[model samples]
Target: MTPFTIETNQYLTQETQGFYHTDFGGVNLPNNPNYLYKLKNDPHHNWSDDWIRQSQEQLYRVLLIDLPEVQNHIGKNPLTICVVPRAKADNTYNPNQLLFKAGVRNAIITLGNSFIDGTNYIQRHTNTKTTHLRQPIDGYNNDGSNPYVGITNATCNISNNVVGKDVLLIDDIYTRTVNIDEDAIQALISKGAKSVSFYAIGKTVFNH
Candidate 1:
Protein backbone atom coordinates (compact mmCIF):
# COMPACT_ATOMS: atom_id res chain seq x y z
CA MET A 1 0.00 0.00 0.00
CA THR A 2 1.32 3.42 -0.94
CA PRO A 3 1.53 5.72 2.04
CA PHE A 4 -0.06 9.17 1.83
CA THR A 5 1.40 12.05 3.82
CA ILE A 6 -0.64 14.37 6.07
CA GLU A 7 0.82 17.74 6.95
CA THR A 8 -0.42 19.90 9.82
CA ASN A 9 0.63 23.35 11.03
CA GLN A 10 -0.54 22.86 14.59
CA TYR A 11 3.04 23.30 15.64
CA LEU A 12 4.68 26.63 14.82
CA THR A 13 8.30 25.59 14.26
CA GLN A 14 7.68 21.93 13.39
CA GLU A 15 5.06 20.39 11.12
CA THR A 16 3.59 17.08 12.19
CA GLN A 17 3.95 14.38 9.51
CA GLY A 18 1.19 11.79 9.22
CA PHE A 19 0.61 8.67 7.14
CA TYR A 20 -2.35 6.36 6.81
CA HIS A 21 -3.72 3.40 4.89
CA THR A 22 -6.99 4.85 3.51
CA ASP A 23 -9.42 7.73 3.52
CA PHE A 24 -12.05 7.90 6.25
CA GLY A 25 -14.63 8.60 3.47
CA GLY A 26 -17.07 10.31 5.86
CA VAL A 27 -18.61 10.25 9.27
CA ASN A 28 -19.74 6.83 10.37
CA LEU A 29 -23.41 7.30 10.94
CA PRO A 30 -25.89 4.54 11.62
CA ASN A 31 -27.43 5.00 8.22
CA ASN A 32 -24.11 5.57 6.44
CA PRO A 33 -21.58 2.98 7.49
CA ASN A 34 -17.94 2.43 6.49
CA TYR A 35 -15.08 0.47 7.94
CA LEU A 36 -13.84 3.32 10.11
CA TYR A 37 -17.38 4.18 11.15
CA LYS A 38 -17.97 0.66 12.30
CA LEU A 39 -14.68 0.56 14.14
CA LYS A 40 -15.07 3.90 15.88
CA ASN A 41 -18.77 3.77 16.57
CA ASP A 42 -18.62 0.12 17.47
CA PRO A 43 -22.33 0.30 18.25
CA HIS A 44 -22.42 -3.23 19.55
CA HIS A 45 -19.26 -2.70 21.61
CA ASN A 46 -17.88 -5.89 20.10
CA TRP A 47 -14.27 -5.15 20.96
CA SER A 48 -14.00 -8.59 22.47
CA ASP A 49 -11.64 -11.47 21.97
CA ASP A 50 -12.72 -12.04 18.41
CA TRP A 51 -12.50 -8.35 17.61
CA ILE A 52 -9.03 -8.16 19.14
CA ARG A 53 -7.85 -11.13 17.13
CA GLN A 54 -9.15 -9.65 13.90
CA SER A 55 -7.75 -6.23 14.70
CA GLN A 56 -4.37 -7.74 15.47
CA GLU A 57 -4.35 -9.54 12.15
CA GLN A 58 -5.24 -6.37 10.30
CA LEU A 59 -2.58 -4.31 12.08
CA TYR A 60 -0.01 -6.99 11.43
CA ARG A 61 -0.70 -6.71 7.75
CA VAL A 62 -0.25 -2.94 7.84
CA LEU A 63 3.01 -3.15 9.75
CA LEU A 64 4.31 -5.92 7.56
CA ILE A 65 3.69 -3.84 4.44
CA ASP A 66 4.07 -0.22 5.50
CA LEU A 67 6.52 -0.18 8.43
CA PRO A 68 9.51 -0.47 6.12
CA GLU A 69 8.40 2.57 4.18
CA VAL A 70 7.84 4.44 7.42
CA GLN A 71 11.29 3.45 8.62
CA ASN A 72 12.82 4.73 5.41
CA HIS A 73 11.07 8.04 5.93
CA ILE A 74 12.21 8.24 9.54
CA GLY A 75 15.79 7.32 8.66
CA LYS A 76 18.21 6.28 11.42
CA ASN A 77 17.07 8.12 14.48
CA PRO A 78 16.80 6.27 17.73
CA LEU A 79 13.04 5.95 17.85
CA THR A 80 10.36 5.57 20.50
CA ILE A 81 6.73 4.66 19.87
CA CYS A 82 3.99 6.56 21.64
CA VAL A 83 0.24 6.53 21.19
CA VAL A 84 -2.42 9.17 21.50
CA PRO A 85 -4.04 8.61 24.84
CA ARG A 86 -7.47 7.08 24.76
CA ALA A 87 -10.32 9.04 26.28
CA LYS A 88 -10.46 8.86 30.06
CA ALA A 89 -13.66 6.90 29.57
CA ASP A 90 -12.16 4.35 27.22
CA ASN A 91 -9.21 3.34 29.38
CA THR A 92 -11.03 0.20 30.43
CA TYR A 93 -9.52 -1.60 27.48
CA ASN A 94 -8.00 0.39 24.68
CA PRO A 95 -8.15 -1.40 21.37
CA ASN A 96 -5.67 1.11 20.00
CA GLN A 97 -3.00 -0.30 22.29
CA LEU A 98 -3.90 -3.77 21.20
CA LEU A 99 -3.52 -2.79 17.57
CA PHE A 100 -0.16 -1.20 18.29
CA LYS A 101 1.06 -4.23 20.16
CA ALA A 102 0.14 -6.36 17.18
CA GLY A 103 2.08 -4.09 14.87
CA VAL A 104 5.12 -4.30 17.13
CA ARG A 105 4.90 -8.05 17.12
CA ASN A 106 5.24 -8.10 13.36
CA ALA A 107 7.40 -5.02 12.89
CA ILE A 108 10.66 -5.27 10.98
CA ILE A 109 11.91 -2.25 12.91
CA THR A 110 13.78 -3.18 16.06
CA LEU A 111 12.07 -1.84 19.16
CA GLY A 112 12.19 -2.79 22.78
CA ASN A 113 9.34 -2.73 25.27
CA SER A 114 10.69 0.57 26.59
CA PHE A 115 10.16 2.12 23.15
CA ILE A 116 6.37 1.65 23.20
CA ASP A 117 5.37 3.78 26.15
CA GLY A 118 2.06 5.54 25.65
CA THR A 119 0.40 4.85 28.95
CA ASN A 120 3.38 5.84 31.03
CA TYR A 121 4.27 9.22 29.53
CA ILE A 122 1.24 11.13 28.20
CA GLN A 123 -2.41 10.83 29.18
CA ARG A 124 -5.82 12.48 28.87
CA HIS A 125 -7.44 13.97 31.93
CA THR A 126 -10.99 14.79 30.83
CA ASN A 127 -13.51 13.49 28.35
CA THR A 128 -14.86 15.91 25.83
CA LYS A 129 -18.49 15.99 24.87
CA THR A 130 -19.30 13.98 21.78
CA THR A 131 -20.68 15.77 18.74
CA HIS A 132 -21.48 14.71 15.20
CA LEU A 133 -21.51 18.25 13.88
CA ARG A 134 -18.39 20.17 13.01
CA GLN A 135 -17.06 22.76 15.41
CA PRO A 136 -14.48 25.54 15.30
CA ILE A 137 -10.78 24.90 15.64
CA ASP A 138 -10.94 24.65 19.37
CA GLY A 139 -9.59 22.50 22.13
CA TYR A 140 -11.74 20.05 24.11
CA ASN A 141 -11.56 21.79 27.44
CA ASN A 142 -14.78 23.30 28.77
CA ASP A 143 -12.70 26.27 29.89
CA GLY A 144 -12.39 27.45 26.26
CA SER A 145 -8.71 26.58 26.10
CA ASN A 146 -7.12 24.67 23.25
CA PRO A 147 -8.65 21.24 22.82
CA TYR A 148 -5.39 19.86 24.13
CA VAL A 149 -4.43 22.74 26.36
CA GLY A 150 -4.06 20.40 29.28
CA ILE A 151 -1.43 18.44 27.42
CA THR A 152 0.49 21.49 26.37
CA ASN A 153 0.28 22.93 29.87
CA ALA A 154 1.69 19.74 31.27
CA THR A 155 -1.42 19.31 33.37
CA CYS A 156 -2.05 15.98 31.68
CA ASN A 157 1.34 14.90 33.04
CA ILE A 158 3.79 14.42 30.17
CA SER A 159 7.26 13.28 31.02
CA ASN A 160 9.69 16.15 30.51
CA ASN A 161 12.61 13.80 30.04
CA VAL A 162 12.29 12.91 26.34
CA VAL A 163 14.55 15.70 25.15
CA GLY A 164 16.54 13.84 22.52
CA LYS A 165 14.16 11.05 21.52
CA ASP A 166 12.44 10.69 18.17
CA VAL A 167 8.82 9.73 18.77
CA LEU A 168 6.45 7.89 16.48
CA LEU A 169 2.92 8.65 17.64
CA ILE A 170 0.09 6.31 16.78
CA ASP A 171 -3.65 6.64 16.64
CA ASP A 172 -6.59 4.74 15.21
CA ILE A 173 -8.37 7.52 13.33
CA TYR A 174 -7.49 10.91 11.87
CA THR A 175 -10.16 13.60 11.64
CA ARG A 176 -10.07 17.06 10.07
CA THR A 177 -9.62 18.68 13.46
CA VAL A 178 -6.82 16.53 14.72
CA ASN A 179 -6.26 18.71 17.74
CA ILE A 180 -5.59 15.87 20.11
CA ASP A 181 -2.93 14.33 17.91
CA GLU A 182 -1.35 17.69 17.18
CA ASP A 183 -1.43 18.70 20.80
CA ALA A 184 0.26 15.50 21.75
CA ILE A 185 2.98 16.33 19.27
CA GLN A 186 3.39 19.80 20.70
CA ALA A 187 3.53 18.47 24.22
CA LEU A 188 6.19 15.98 23.26
CA ILE A 189 8.23 18.61 21.49
CA SER A 190 7.95 21.00 24.41
CA LYS A 191 9.14 18.23 26.68
CA GLY A 192 12.18 17.87 24.41
CA ALA A 193 11.37 15.28 21.82
CA LYS A 194 13.73 15.70 18.87
CA SER A 195 11.08 14.89 16.25
CA VAL A 196 7.60 13.45 16.06
CA SER A 197 5.82 11.47 13.33
CA PHE A 198 2.21 10.35 13.37
CA TYR A 199 0.47 7.32 11.90
CA ALA A 200 -3.16 6.37 11.94
CA ILE A 201 -5.17 3.50 10.55
CA GLY A 202 -7.77 5.73 8.94
CA LYS A 203 -7.98 9.35 7.84
CA THR A 204 -11.46 10.88 7.87
CA VAL A 205 -12.47 12.35 4.52
CA PHE A 206 -15.62 14.37 4.92
CA ASN A 207 -17.98 13.87 1.98
CA HIS A 208 -20.96 16.09 1.68
Candidate 2:
Protein backbone atom coordinates (compact mmCIF):
# COMPACT_ATOMS: atom_id res chain seq x y z
CA MET A 1 0.00 0.00 0.00
CA THR A 2 1.17 3.57 -0.64
CA PRO A 3 2.41 5.40 2.47
CA PHE A 4 0.87 8.68 3.59
CA THR A 5 3.06 11.77 3.97
CA ILE A 6 2.88 13.71 7.19
CA GLU A 7 3.15 17.26 5.94
CA THR A 8 5.45 19.68 7.72
CA ASN A 9 3.62 22.28 9.72
CA GLN A 10 4.38 24.91 12.35
CA TYR A 11 5.51 22.31 14.88
CA LEU A 12 7.76 20.34 12.55
CA THR A 13 10.85 21.36 10.62
CA GLN A 14 10.78 18.40 8.24
CA GLU A 15 8.15 16.30 6.49
CA THR A 16 7.83 12.95 8.21
CA GLN A 17 5.61 10.43 6.47
CA GLY A 18 4.07 7.10 7.49
CA PHE A 19 1.41 4.49 6.68
CA TYR A 20 -1.56 3.49 8.79
CA HIS A 21 -3.06 0.06 8.28
CA THR A 22 -6.50 1.33 9.27
CA ASP A 23 -8.46 4.56 9.61
CA PHE A 24 -9.55 6.02 12.97
CA GLY A 25 -12.59 8.30 12.95
CA GLY A 26 -11.87 11.00 15.52
CA VAL A 27 -12.69 10.70 19.24
CA ASN A 28 -15.85 9.11 20.67
CA LEU A 29 -17.24 7.98 17.38
CA PRO A 30 -19.48 5.19 18.61
CA ASN A 31 -20.54 4.20 15.13
CA ASN A 32 -16.99 3.65 13.88
CA PRO A 33 -14.94 1.94 16.53
CA ASN A 34 -11.34 1.03 15.71
CA TYR A 35 -9.47 -1.98 17.06
CA LEU A 36 -6.17 -0.11 17.25
CA TYR A 37 -7.86 2.68 19.16
CA LYS A 38 -9.37 0.20 21.58
CA LEU A 39 -5.99 -1.40 22.19
CA LYS A 40 -4.30 1.91 22.85
CA ASN A 41 -6.95 3.54 25.02
CA ASP A 42 -8.16 0.58 27.06
CA PRO A 43 -4.86 -1.01 27.79
CA HIS A 44 -5.79 -2.20 31.26
CA HIS A 45 -8.47 -4.43 29.87
CA ASN A 46 -6.79 -5.13 26.56
CA TRP A 47 -3.50 -6.45 27.92
CA SER A 48 -4.69 -10.02 28.01
CA ASP A 49 -2.87 -12.84 26.25
CA ASP A 50 -5.46 -13.08 23.51
CA TRP A 51 -5.47 -9.33 22.94
CA ILE A 52 -1.68 -9.22 22.84
CA ARG A 53 -1.51 -12.07 20.38
CA GLN A 54 -3.99 -10.33 18.10
CA SER A 55 -2.13 -7.06 18.38
CA GLN A 56 1.12 -8.76 17.49
CA GLU A 57 -0.51 -10.37 14.50
CA GLN A 58 -1.70 -7.00 13.20
CA LEU A 59 1.70 -5.41 13.78
CA TYR A 60 3.45 -8.38 12.19
CA ARG A 61 1.46 -7.83 9.03
CA VAL A 62 2.64 -4.24 8.89
CA LEU A 63 6.27 -5.15 9.52
CA LEU A 64 6.10 -7.92 6.97
CA ILE A 65 4.64 -5.67 4.27
CA ASP A 66 5.01 -1.97 5.05
CA LEU A 67 8.46 -2.09 6.65
CA PRO A 68 10.25 -3.34 3.56
CA GLU A 69 8.82 -0.47 1.58
CA VAL A 70 10.01 1.97 4.21
CA GLN A 71 13.44 0.36 4.13
CA ASN A 72 13.61 0.75 0.35
CA HIS A 73 12.93 4.43 0.73
CA ILE A 74 15.91 4.87 3.06
CA GLY A 75 18.35 2.91 0.88
CA LYS A 76 21.40 1.22 2.45
CA ASN A 77 21.27 2.83 5.86
CA PRO A 78 19.98 0.50 8.59
CA LEU A 79 17.08 1.72 10.69
CA THR A 80 16.81 1.50 14.45
CA ILE A 81 13.32 1.18 15.87
CA CYS A 82 12.17 3.26 18.81
CA VAL A 83 8.71 3.86 20.20
CA VAL A 84 7.49 7.29 21.23
CA PRO A 85 7.64 6.97 25.02
CA ARG A 86 4.57 6.80 27.12
CA ALA A 87 3.80 9.22 29.94
CA LYS A 88 5.44 8.69 33.33
CA ALA A 89 2.20 7.29 34.65
CA ASP A 90 2.51 4.43 32.21
CA ASN A 91 6.04 3.40 33.16
CA THR A 92 5.04 -0.10 34.15
CA TYR A 93 5.04 -2.36 31.15
CA ASN A 94 2.94 -0.12 28.97
CA PRO A 95 1.13 -1.33 25.89
CA ASN A 96 3.20 0.84 23.55
CA GLN A 97 6.45 -0.83 24.55
CA LEU A 98 4.88 -4.24 24.42
CA LEU A 99 3.56 -3.62 20.93
CA PHE A 100 6.93 -2.25 19.84
CA LYS A 101 8.73 -5.32 21.14
CA ALA A 102 6.31 -7.58 19.34
CA GLY A 103 6.91 -5.80 16.06
CA VAL A 104 10.67 -5.73 16.59
CA ARG A 105 10.77 -9.46 17.22
CA ASN A 106 8.89 -10.09 13.99
CA ALA A 107 11.22 -7.77 12.09
CA ILE A 108 14.23 -9.57 13.46
CA ILE A 109 12.85 -12.93 12.40
CA THR A 110 12.23 -11.70 8.85
CA LEU A 111 14.71 -8.88 8.15
CA GLY A 112 17.47 -9.79 10.65
CA ASN A 113 18.30 -8.36 14.04
CA SER A 114 20.83 -5.89 12.67
CA PHE A 115 18.21 -3.93 10.76
CA ILE A 116 16.13 -3.02 13.78
CA ASP A 117 17.37 -2.24 17.27
CA GLY A 118 14.65 -2.40 19.95
CA THR A 119 15.98 0.22 22.30
CA ASN A 120 13.88 2.16 24.78
CA TYR A 121 16.11 5.16 24.29
CA ILE A 122 13.49 7.86 24.46
CA GLN A 123 11.46 8.29 27.69
CA ARG A 124 9.28 10.76 29.47
CA HIS A 125 10.78 12.76 32.31
CA THR A 126 7.49 13.44 34.08
CA ASN A 127 3.77 13.00 33.69
CA THR A 128 1.79 15.61 31.89
CA LYS A 129 -1.89 16.13 31.31
CA THR A 130 -3.24 13.42 29.01
CA THR A 131 -3.50 14.62 25.42
CA HIS A 132 -6.46 12.33 24.71
CA LEU A 133 -9.02 15.11 24.97
CA ARG A 134 -6.88 18.07 23.99
CA GLN A 135 -5.61 19.53 20.74
CA PRO A 136 -2.04 18.96 19.57
CA ILE A 137 -0.87 22.40 20.61
CA ASP A 138 -2.05 21.66 24.15
CA GLY A 139 0.33 18.72 24.50
CA TYR A 140 3.80 18.53 26.03
CA ASN A 141 6.46 21.21 25.60
CA ASN A 142 10.24 21.42 25.35
CA ASP A 143 10.47 25.08 26.29
CA GLY A 144 13.22 24.42 28.87
CA SER A 145 10.78 24.94 31.70
CA ASN A 146 7.85 22.53 31.61
CA PRO A 147 8.36 19.40 33.67
CA TYR A 148 6.90 17.15 31.00
CA VAL A 149 8.70 18.44 27.93
CA GLY A 150 7.80 15.46 25.80
CA ILE A 151 11.18 14.15 24.61
CA THR A 152 13.26 17.02 25.97
CA ASN A 153 15.28 15.12 28.56
CA ALA A 154 14.46 11.66 27.20
CA THR A 155 17.25 9.20 27.88
CA CYS A 156 19.16 7.50 25.08
CA ASN A 157 20.49 4.15 26.29
CA ILE A 158 22.58 3.14 23.30
CA SER A 159 26.15 2.29 24.25
CA ASN A 160 27.60 3.23 20.89
CA ASN A 161 26.87 6.61 19.36
CA VAL A 162 24.08 7.05 16.79
CA VAL A 163 25.95 9.77 14.94
CA GLY A 164 24.72 8.81 11.48
CA LYS A 165 22.02 6.23 12.05
CA ASP A 166 18.61 6.30 10.45
CA VAL A 167 15.78 5.86 12.93
CA LEU A 168 12.29 4.46 12.41
CA LEU A 169 10.12 6.02 15.07
CA ILE A 170 6.98 4.12 15.96
CA ASP A 171 3.90 5.34 17.74
CA ASP A 172 0.53 3.71 18.44
CA ILE A 173 -1.45 6.64 17.10
CA TYR A 174 -0.97 9.94 15.30
CA THR A 175 -3.04 12.94 16.32
CA ARG A 176 -4.18 15.79 14.10
CA THR A 177 -1.49 18.05 15.58
CA VAL A 178 2.21 17.19 15.65
CA ASN A 179 3.47 18.24 19.08
CA ILE A 180 4.30 14.87 20.60
CA ASP A 181 5.44 13.02 17.50
CA GLU A 182 7.39 16.02 16.19
CA ASP A 183 9.10 16.41 19.57
CA ALA A 184 10.07 12.76 19.47
CA ILE A 185 11.62 13.01 15.99
CA GLN A 186 13.44 16.19 16.98
CA ALA A 187 14.81 14.53 20.09
CA LEU A 188 16.15 11.56 18.13
CA ILE A 189 17.81 13.81 15.53
CA SER A 190 19.27 16.00 18.27
CA LYS A 191 20.88 12.90 19.75
CA GLY A 192 22.81 12.31 16.49
CA ALA A 193 20.35 10.23 14.50
CA LYS A 194 20.93 11.15 10.85
CA SER A 195 17.25 11.08 9.94
CA VAL A 196 13.93 9.88 11.28
CA SER A 197 10.84 8.39 9.70
CA PHE A 198 7.62 7.72 11.53
CA TYR A 199 5.06 4.89 11.54
CA ALA A 200 1.84 4.28 13.38
CA ILE A 201 -1.18 1.98 13.39
CA GLY A 202 -3.65 4.82 12.82
CA LYS A 203 -4.02 8.59 12.36
CA THR A 204 -6.83 10.37 14.17
CA VAL A 205 -9.25 12.66 12.36
CA PHE A 206 -10.76 15.13 14.79
CA ASN A 207 -14.45 15.86 14.41
CA HIS A 208 -14.03 19.51 15.25
Candidate 3:
Protein backbone atom coordinates (compact mmCIF):
# COMPACT_ATOMS: atom_id res chain seq x y z
CA MET A 1 0.00 0.00 0.00
CA THR A 2 1.12 3.53 -0.74
CA PRO A 3 1.71 6.01 2.11
CA PHE A 4 0.87 9.72 2.40
CA THR A 5 2.90 12.21 4.41
CA ILE A 6 0.92 14.22 6.98
CA GLU A 7 1.39 17.94 6.54
CA THR A 8 2.94 19.83 9.43
CA ASN A 9 1.75 23.14 10.91
CA GLN A 10 2.71 25.50 13.75
CA TYR A 11 1.22 23.27 16.46
CA LEU A 12 2.47 20.01 14.92
CA THR A 13 6.11 21.14 15.00
CA GLN A 14 8.49 20.90 12.02
CA GLU A 15 10.89 18.73 13.98
CA THR A 16 8.37 15.84 14.15
CA GLN A 17 7.02 14.06 11.06
CA GLY A 18 3.79 12.12 10.44
CA PHE A 19 2.60 9.45 8.01
CA TYR A 20 -0.66 7.64 7.22
CA HIS A 21 -1.68 4.71 5.00
CA THR A 22 -4.89 5.71 3.16
CA ASP A 23 -7.52 8.40 2.55
CA PHE A 24 -10.87 8.38 4.33
CA GLY A 25 -14.06 10.11 3.16
CA GLY A 26 -15.80 10.06 6.53
CA VAL A 27 -18.99 8.28 7.73
CA ASN A 28 -21.84 10.21 6.10
CA LEU A 29 -20.03 10.65 2.81
CA PRO A 30 -20.68 8.32 -0.08
CA ASN A 31 -18.03 6.34 -2.08
CA ASN A 32 -15.72 5.84 0.87
CA PRO A 33 -16.60 3.08 3.28
CA ASN A 34 -12.90 2.69 4.02
CA TYR A 35 -11.71 -0.05 6.40
CA LEU A 36 -10.69 2.29 9.22
CA TYR A 37 -14.01 4.14 9.08
CA LYS A 38 -15.99 0.92 9.26
CA LEU A 39 -13.86 -0.42 12.10
CA LYS A 40 -14.42 2.78 14.01
CA ASN A 41 -18.14 3.17 13.39
CA ASP A 42 -19.75 -0.17 12.48
CA PRO A 43 -21.46 -0.41 15.84
CA HIS A 44 -23.10 2.99 15.40
CA HIS A 45 -24.26 1.94 11.94
CA ASN A 46 -25.98 -1.11 13.42
CA TRP A 47 -23.51 -3.55 11.87
CA SER A 48 -22.87 -6.79 13.69
CA ASP A 49 -20.00 -7.25 16.14
CA ASP A 50 -18.61 -9.81 13.70
CA TRP A 51 -18.27 -7.04 11.14
CA ILE A 52 -16.25 -5.00 13.60
CA ARG A 53 -13.95 -7.92 14.30
CA GLN A 54 -13.44 -8.52 10.59
CA SER A 55 -12.53 -4.87 10.05
CA GLN A 56 -10.05 -5.02 12.91
CA GLU A 57 -8.53 -8.23 11.61
CA GLN A 58 -8.18 -6.64 8.20
CA LEU A 59 -6.41 -3.62 9.73
CA TYR A 60 -4.12 -5.93 11.65
CA ARG A 61 -2.96 -7.40 8.36
CA VAL A 62 -2.42 -3.95 6.83
CA LEU A 63 -0.50 -2.65 9.86
CA LEU A 64 1.90 -5.57 9.67
CA ILE A 65 2.61 -4.76 6.03
CA ASP A 66 2.49 -0.94 6.05
CA LEU A 67 3.96 0.08 9.40
CA PRO A 68 7.44 -0.82 8.19
CA GLU A 69 7.04 1.92 5.59
CA VAL A 70 6.54 4.42 8.40
CA GLN A 71 9.45 2.85 10.29
CA ASN A 72 11.74 3.70 7.40
CA HIS A 73 11.20 7.39 8.26
CA ILE A 74 12.12 7.02 11.92
CA GLY A 75 15.88 7.66 12.06
CA LYS A 76 16.19 6.44 15.64
CA ASN A 77 16.83 2.89 16.78
CA PRO A 78 14.32 0.85 18.78
CA LEU A 79 11.17 2.96 18.48
CA THR A 80 8.20 2.47 20.77
CA ILE A 81 4.66 2.55 19.33
CA CYS A 82 2.12 4.63 21.24
CA VAL A 83 -1.55 4.84 20.30
CA VAL A 84 -3.73 7.94 20.63
CA PRO A 85 -6.45 7.21 23.12
CA ARG A 86 -10.12 7.09 22.16
CA ALA A 87 -12.87 9.55 23.15
CA LYS A 88 -13.86 7.70 26.29
CA ALA A 89 -11.55 7.07 29.20
CA ASP A 90 -9.56 3.84 28.91
CA ASN A 91 -11.28 1.97 31.73
CA THR A 92 -14.70 2.97 30.45
CA TYR A 93 -14.31 1.47 26.99
CA ASN A 94 -16.25 -1.62 25.90
CA PRO A 95 -15.03 -4.22 23.42
CA ASN A 96 -16.24 -2.05 20.56
CA GLN A 97 -14.41 0.98 21.90
CA LEU A 98 -11.24 -1.09 22.16
CA LEU A 99 -11.10 -2.24 18.52
CA PHE A 100 -8.45 0.16 17.17
CA LYS A 101 -5.96 -0.30 20.00
CA ALA A 102 -6.54 -4.05 19.89
CA GLY A 103 -5.48 -4.09 16.26
CA VAL A 104 -2.33 -2.12 17.14
CA ARG A 105 -1.56 -4.52 19.99
CA ASN A 106 -1.80 -7.51 17.65
CA ALA A 107 0.41 -5.86 15.06
CA ILE A 108 3.12 -5.11 17.60
CA ILE A 109 3.06 -8.71 18.78
CA THR A 110 3.76 -9.93 15.26
CA LEU A 111 6.34 -7.24 14.42
CA GLY A 112 8.69 -8.58 17.15
CA ASN A 113 11.66 -6.66 18.52
CA SER A 114 11.79 -3.93 15.92
CA PHE A 115 8.81 -2.14 17.48
CA ILE A 116 8.20 -1.89 21.21
CA ASP A 117 4.50 -2.19 22.18
CA GLY A 118 3.73 0.98 24.09
CA THR A 119 0.12 1.24 22.94
CA ASN A 120 -0.96 2.25 26.42
CA TYR A 121 2.02 4.52 26.95
CA ILE A 122 -0.43 7.41 26.92
CA GLN A 123 -3.71 6.78 28.71
CA ARG A 124 -6.83 8.92 28.70
CA HIS A 125 -8.41 9.14 32.13
CA THR A 126 -11.25 11.56 31.26
CA ASN A 127 -13.94 11.37 28.62
CA THR A 128 -13.77 13.83 25.74
CA LYS A 129 -16.36 14.79 23.17
CA THR A 130 -16.30 12.30 20.30
CA THR A 131 -15.17 14.26 17.25
CA HIS A 132 -17.19 12.30 14.67
CA LEU A 133 -20.40 12.94 16.54
CA ARG A 134 -20.20 16.52 15.25
CA GLN A 135 -21.50 18.34 18.24
CA PRO A 136 -21.94 22.10 17.96
CA ILE A 137 -19.24 22.89 20.49
CA ASP A 138 -15.78 23.34 18.96
CA GLY A 139 -13.30 21.17 20.81
CA TYR A 140 -10.23 22.94 19.48
CA ASN A 141 -10.98 26.53 20.48
CA ASN A 142 -11.57 26.19 24.19
CA ASP A 143 -8.81 23.63 24.73
CA GLY A 144 -7.29 24.74 28.03
CA SER A 145 -10.64 25.76 29.47
CA ASN A 146 -12.25 22.32 29.08
CA PRO A 147 -11.21 18.72 29.38
CA TYR A 148 -13.42 17.76 26.43
CA VAL A 149 -11.76 20.38 24.23
CA GLY A 150 -9.66 17.61 22.64
CA ILE A 151 -6.93 15.09 23.42
CA THR A 152 -4.68 17.04 25.81
CA ASN A 153 -2.61 16.45 28.92
CA ALA A 154 -5.57 17.57 31.04
CA THR A 155 -7.35 14.34 30.11
CA CYS A 156 -4.42 11.97 29.60
CA ASN A 157 -1.48 10.45 31.42
CA ILE A 158 1.86 10.03 29.68
CA SER A 159 4.07 7.19 30.86
CA ASN A 160 7.53 7.96 32.26
CA ASN A 161 8.96 5.27 29.97
CA VAL A 162 8.55 7.70 27.06
CA VAL A 163 11.40 9.81 28.46
CA GLY A 164 14.42 9.82 26.11
CA LYS A 165 12.70 7.32 23.81
CA ASP A 166 11.80 7.74 20.17
CA VAL A 167 8.01 7.41 19.92
CA LEU A 168 5.78 6.65 16.96
CA LEU A 169 2.25 7.81 17.80
CA ILE A 170 -0.53 5.96 16.02
CA ASP A 171 -4.17 6.88 15.47
CA ASP A 172 -7.05 5.27 13.56
CA ILE A 173 -7.70 8.45 11.60
CA TYR A 174 -6.08 11.85 11.21
CA THR A 175 -8.31 14.88 10.71
CA ARG A 176 -6.96 18.41 10.58
CA THR A 177 -9.91 20.15 12.23
CA VAL A 178 -9.98 18.35 15.54
CA ASN A 179 -6.23 18.03 15.71
CA ILE A 180 -6.33 15.03 18.01
CA ASP A 181 -3.12 13.62 16.58
CA GLU A 182 -1.41 16.96 17.05
CA ASP A 183 -2.45 17.11 20.66
CA ALA A 184 -1.09 13.62 21.22
CA ILE A 185 2.20 14.68 19.66
CA GLN A 186 2.40 17.63 22.04
CA ALA A 187 1.58 15.44 25.04
CA LEU A 188 4.33 12.99 24.18
CA ILE A 189 6.93 15.68 23.57
CA SER A 190 6.02 17.54 26.76
CA LYS A 191 6.68 14.28 28.60
CA GLY A 192 10.29 14.36 27.40
CA ALA A 193 10.15 11.97 24.43
CA LYS A 194 13.41 12.23 22.49
CA SER A 195 11.55 12.29 19.19
CA VAL A 196 8.01 11.65 17.93
CA SER A 197 6.67 10.51 14.57
CA PHE A 198 3.00 9.93 13.80
CA TYR A 199 1.01 7.33 11.79
CA ALA A 200 -2.68 7.12 11.10
CA ILE A 201 -4.45 4.19 9.43
CA GLY A 202 -6.41 6.68 7.34
CA LYS A 203 -6.49 10.45 6.78
CA THR A 204 -9.59 12.50 6.00
CA VAL A 205 -9.70 13.65 2.38
CA PHE A 206 -12.67 15.96 1.88
CA ASN A 207 -12.58 16.46 -1.87
CA HIS A 208 -12.03 12.77 -2.58
Question: In TM-score terms, which candidate is top?
Answer: 3
In TM-score terms, candidate 2 sits at 0.71
| Candidate 3 lDDT, 1-208, residue by residue in tens | 3454545554555455767777777656664436565565534456676777688878898899878877876666688999998776788657676778888988988988888989988888877766665554433332222322335788888899999999999988777756677777877888899888888877778521
TM-score versus the correct structure, for each prediction: 0.67, 0.71, 0.82
- On lDDT, the leading prediction is 3
Residue 85 in candidate 1 has what lDDT? 55
**What are the clashing pairs of model 1?**
139-146, 139-147, 140-147
Where in model 1 is the C-alpha error above 4 Å?
A: 1-13, 26-44, 89-119, 130-155
Give the alpha carbon lDDT tens digit for every residue of 4-112 in model 2.
Answer: 7766655556787666555567546753324454345343344566765676676677667766776786563577777775544336445654555556556656877
Model 2 clash count equals 0
Instruction: Give the per-residue Cα lDDT of candidate 2 at 1.
Output: 35
**Global lDDT of each candidate:** 0.56, 0.60, 0.74
